[model samples]
Target: MSFTCSDCGKGFTRSSSLQRHQSVHTGERPFTCSVCGKGFTRSSHLQAHQSIHTGQKPFTCSYCGKGFTGSTDLLAHQSVHTGEKPFSCSDCGKGFSRSFSLQRHQRVHTGERPFTCSMCGKGFTRSGSLQTHLRFHTGEWPFTCSDCGKRFTRSSDLLAHQLVHTGKMLFSCSDCGKGFTRSFSLQRHQSVHTGEKPFTCSVCGKGFARSSHLQTHQSVHTGGKLFTRSDCGKGFTGSTDLLTHKRVHTGETV
Candidate 1:
């Protein structure tokens, strides 16, 4: 004999299971976790939720010795070691180990940023990334270095900055072999080798390797003198020209 749900016409082997299933339709969750106050329909579901707060993972992977809260999660972790990418993106054909990961990656192609910041109205692909970005607006630096007491918003940024204290430069330019603390600096160095001048002046249509150089060059067309001589009250367009003019009074060799 099977217990049936009148609301959804679903049959259950036990009356208790049918009663638990009915809670899904009624949105009634009796079992609640004390730690997080999260409600669940079944006691077993509430037990699993408690494990997240307790940091208790009972299931262990046989291959890599990785721990998970459930046997299904343990099986999922094992797929990474096996190099099994079962889930694939329909738009770009990119493979992922998990179906949820693939669904998240698909949002990149769809331009669907579900996670949004309430303060700035900025959208992010992941909720965790948005949470980290919120630290910038709140001026919260949680991660701190024990060595210098330097603070950072994320743990990854703190780890990278710690390499500076050790005098370690992992990123290097291929052309000049000059090392840099960050990959963004190494990429900018590589542009010099390729002779790539991305920044340009709008008024004169002049190109420059950097935005700062372009900004300085734009001052030439502004018809305003920024540098002034204190002795003669003479004005110059650039600081270098004013410094050269002051050499007449200082008696310095040019």
Candidate 2:
């Protein structure tokens, strides 16, 4: 017998599955995390979240040696080694390793911004994006670097920053043999050989290999100096220009 959700009319194989589906409409989260007081619809989700507090990653990836608190996360990480993307978008034909990532990507085509910031009323495609946006209003930088004591709003930013202290260039260009701490940097470097400019400006129709370069180029049309020095109050179009200007004050020779 097929069980159906009353609210959404979604069919389920079992009554238990239907009950779980009802929680989405009811906004009911019975399981609560003791450490952070975060709520989850399922006990397994709560257990998975608890590992964040304990720092206990029992599930280790056989391919990369990376540890994950949950088996589902480990399965997702394994896709990186296998190059397997089971979840695919019907709209744009983009493949994703995880279902959650595919759902987030679908929002881009649908223009569905379900998650919204409470402070600024800005909409985001994913909850993680909303959480990161909320951090700016709350002045919360949860991720910290041990080497430099620098704080970042996102864990990915912290991970990228830590590579600077370690001098670890994990990503390398096949064309030029140049190394980069981030994969996007290597991708940008490869564009020099391929002559691919993916990021295009709406104003002047100028193409750039990197998004940062495109943003810097956009400032030329708007006449906006985004990066500013606190000491002299002088502004620059790009971060590299701002860093170069700082050397005048420090008297640093390069």
Q: How many residue pairs clash (N, CA or C atoms closer than 3 angstroms) in each of the candidate models, in the order given? A: 0, 0
Per-residue lDDT value at 213 in model 2: 77
Tens digit of lDDT per residue, candidate 1, span 95-211? 877787897777655656656667545556665566676665565777788898887776557768889889999788778889987765787788889887766666878887754
In candidate 2, what are the lDDT values of residues 19-109, reduced to their tens digit? 9867765557789877655567789988987887688999999887989989999998798799999998997676888987897667655
Candidate 1: residue pairs that collide: none
Q: Model 1: residues >4 Å from true position, as ranges?
A: 1-57, 68-73, 145-254
- Model 2 regions lying over 4 Å from their true place: 1-46, 49-55, 173-254
How many backbone clashes are present in model 1?
Answer: 0
- What is the total number of backbone clashes in candidate 2? 0
For candidate 2, give the lDDT: 0.76
lDDT of model number 1: 0.72
